[model samples]
Target: MSPANPFTRRKDRIDELAATAASPSGGIAEAGAVDEKPGVSLIASAWSRLKRSPVFLLGAGITLVFVVLALVSPLIAPHDPAAGLLLDQVRPQSNPVPGPQDGFPLGADSRGRDLLSRLLVGSQQTLIVGVFATITGLAGGLSLGILAGAFGGWVDALVMRVVDVMLSIPSLLLAFSIAAVAARPSQVTVIIAVAAVQVPVFARLLRGSMLAQRSSDHVVAARALGVTERAIVFRHMLPNSLAPVIVQSTLVLAVSIIDAAALSFLGLGNPNDRQPEWGQMLGRAQTYIYDYPHLAIYPALCIIVVALGFTLMGESLREALDPKSRR
Candidate 1:
C-alpha cells in the first residue's frame, strides 16, 4: 500500500485519541439508557404500544374475525338459520359433532336448524346487543359524568348518590329487575336491560377521571387564560378524560355480551326460537343438555371467545395508558 499522507495520518490519530478521551470513565457503560424522545399524544402512544403487543394482536384478530362474520353472514352462511335443511340427520351427540350432509357442516340444533348457520347468524345478534348496549351506557354515563365533573357541589352529589344506589346492587340482578318491569321480554328488552346495568359503571368511571383532571395544570391554565367554560370542558377536559372511558367501553362490551346472554338464558330475552341468538340458543339447549352437551357447547364457546377477545384488548389498552404498566 502507498504510504499514508502525513496530514491524513495525523488527523486520523487525533480523532482516535479524542474518542478515547471522551469515552465513559468507568468500564461499565449506561447500557440501558435511551435518549428521551418528544412526547406523543396519548392515543398515538397507546396505538404504538398496542401494535407491539401479542395480546393486542390476538384480540384484534379475533375481534376482526367476528366483525367480518357478522357483516357477511347472509352471503356466506350456507343455509337460512331459521330453517334447518336436514332434520333426519339431526341427532343428539355426547360430544360436539358435525353432520355427514354436505350442506349441513355443523349439524342441526335441537330444532333441526343448521348449527353452523345459527352460529354465524348469531354473531350479528351478539355484536349488535353488545355494541349498542355499551353505546347506550356510554351515552348516559357521559352526560351524567360531565355534569358532575364540570359542575360540582349538588350536581355531583345528586348524580353520585344515584350511581351509588345502583352500584350497591349486583349489576345482573338490576338488569333482571329492569327486564321484568319493562313490559315483556324481547330483543329490545334485552338491550335496555344490559345497558341499564352498565350506565352506573361508566358514569362513576367518567366522574372520577374527570375529577382527577379538573385541577390539572392545563385546565387551570385554560381558566387563567379566560377560555370559555364550555370550550374548556368540551375540548380540553373531555378529550383528555376520555381515554379511560374508551378503554372502559371495551371492557363493558364483554360484560354486555354476558348480561345479554344471561338474560336470554333466564328466558328474559327474545323468546322466539326463529331468532338465532347465542344466549337464546343456550336457553333452548338447556332442556337437552344431559343428552346432548354439544348443543350448549358450540354457542357457549363462541360467546367465551368473543368476550375474551374484547377483554384482552381492553386490558392491553389499560396497560398502555398506565405509565407504570408501560414500563
Candidate 2:
C-alpha cells in the first residue's frame, strides 16, 4: 500500500463508471427504454387528437344528441306524431298553425300534429335516409373505385368517364331526375335518389386517393415483393386510401340529409303524412311559411343543426388525420 498501483486505481474508476451507467435510473438506460417503446397507431393517434379537440367534442355532442333522440323518440314523444290532436285549434281561415301551448311546447304544425313530437319522431326518418343513402353510395363507389384502381387503362377510363358524367350534372337536379322516375313517392325512392347523387362523389374521391397511393413507396415495395395484384389493391391501396373516403362519408351524411329534405320539399318524398319525417314536415310548413314562420322554422332549424354537427365532425376528422397536423 506504500504506493497505490495506478493501473488498479484506473481499473476501479472504470468499473465504478460502468456500474453507474448500467443502473436503472441512468440517463442512457432511461433514454434507451423510451426509444424501445412502441409507437402509437394512426387510428389511435387520430382518436387522441380528436378527444382533445373542442370542435370534435362539440360535433360529437350534437351528433350524439340527435342519435339519441332518434332512438328514443317513440318512447319519449309526448303525443302521437301522426295524430292531428290539435285539429280544433287549427283553422284554415283563422289559426292556420297554432303557437306554443300547454301540451304543445313547440306549437303545432299546419296539420295540427304536435310540432315537438313530430320533430322527435322525424329524427328517425332523417337519420335513416342519411345513413342508408350514404352506405349505399359507399358500396357502389367502392366497387367502381376498386375496379378502376386495380385495373387502370381502359377500365379506369370507362369508370371515370361515367363518374365525370354524373358529376357534370347538378346534384339536386340529378336527384330530382332519379326521384321523378319512380312510380310513386316512397322512402325507398328518396333513399335511392339521394344515394345516386353521392355515388360519383365517393367514387371520384376514392379513385383520386388510390391513384396517389399507387405510386407510393409502399405500393412499389409490395409489387417488388411479388404480392398479388388483388392483394396489393385491396389490402394495401384500398386500406391506405380510405382516410379521405371516411372523412367524406361524414360530410356526405350531412349532404344526404339535406338532399333528402330537398327532395321532400319538392314533393318527391312520401305523400303519407301518417309517417312523419322532418323533411315531410318541412315540406308542409312551406305552405304556411309566411303567415306562420314557426311552422318552417322548427324543422329548418333541426336540419341545419344536425347537418352542422356532421360537417363539424367531418372537418375535425380531416384535420386530425392530416399528416401536416402531426407533431
Candidate 3:
C-alpha cells in the first residue's frame, strides 16, 4: 500500500495540536471554577463567626447608635447647643414644665443652654477627637514598632528606649505639660496630646506582636524563598500582627477619650467657651455644683456614657479577637 501523503500527515498533526490546546483550556476553566468555591466558603465562615459573637454584636450596636446620634444632632436636637436663653435657664426639675419652652425633658444649664443639645453636639467633638487621635497613634506607633521588630540591633534599641522613657512618665502629666506649653488648647492640641501619650503603648504592643509573627513558619518560609524584606514584613507579617493591634486600638480609644476629657477638665482643652465640650462643661459646672447640680451632672454623665461605650467595645473586641476564646 502507498504511504500516506505528506500533506495529509501535516493536517493530522495540526489537528492533534488544536485538540491538545482545547483540552488544557477546558481543564484550566474547570480548575478556576473549583477554586471559587473555597473562596466563597472562607467569606461565609468569617461572617458566621462574627455573627456568633454576642459581645461583638453589642459593641457594634452601641458604636452605631452613637455614630447616628452624632450625625443627626443638628436635626434632632431641640435647641441650639451654644445659644443661651437666660429667661428660661436652669428651671428646676420639679417645675411643672410641659413643653420645650419650659425645658421639661433635659434640664437647662445655668446659662440656659439645652443640656441635651450640648450633649449631642459634644458627642461629635468627642468622637472626632478620639478617632483622629487613635488613627494618628496607630499609624505612628505601628510604623515604629514594625521597624524595630523587623530589624533588630540599634534600630530596636533606639525605638524601645524612647518608648520606655515616654512610658515612665504619667500620661496625664505628660499631656498636661504639653498642653500648657501650647498657645491655647484646641481640638488639634487635644488630639496631639492624646496621640503623644498613646504612641508608646501602641508601639510596645505592636512590637511584641510583630516579633512573634516574624518568627512564625510562614514568615521564615517567605524569607527562604527570597522575597523582599519589605514585602515579607508589610504584606506577610503585617496582616497577622493586626489582630493584637485591633484589640489594643479599641482600648486606646477609650483611654484617649478619657485623657481628652481630663485635659478639658483641667482647663487645657478648647478655650472656646461656645464649643460646649463635655470636659469644658464639667469644668464650668464645678463652680455651680451646689446650686445647679444638673450642670455638673449632665456633662459628667456624657463623659461616663462615652467612656463606658468605648470601654465596652474594647473589652468585647479583645474577647472576640482572642484565638483561645474562639476555641
Winning model by lDDT: 2
TM-score leaderboard ranking: 2, 1, 3
Best by TM-score: 2
Clash pairs, candidate 3, are none
Task: Write candidate 3's Cα lDDT for 1-327 as tens digits.
Answer: 999999999999988866765785664445555434434453355456667767667766777888898888778888788887544534556432212446536766666667788888888888888899999989889888998888978999999999999999999999888888898778899999989998888898888888898889999999999999999989988888887788888888878888998999898889887787788888887866775577778778777776777677777666556756554
lDDT of each: 0.87, 0.91, 0.80
**Clashing residue pairs, backbone N/CA/C < 3 A, model 2:** none
The lowest-lDDT stretch of 10 consecutive residues in candidate 1 is 91-100
Which has the higher lDDT value, candidate number 1 or candidate number 2? 2
Candidate 3 TM-score, true structure as reference: 0.79
Please, what are the lDDT tens digits per residue for candidate 1 over residues 285-311?
A: 887787668889999999999999999
TM-score of each: 0.85, 0.87, 0.79
Clashes of each: 0, 0, 0
Better of 2 and 3 by lDDT: 2
lDDT order, best first, reads: 2, 1, 3
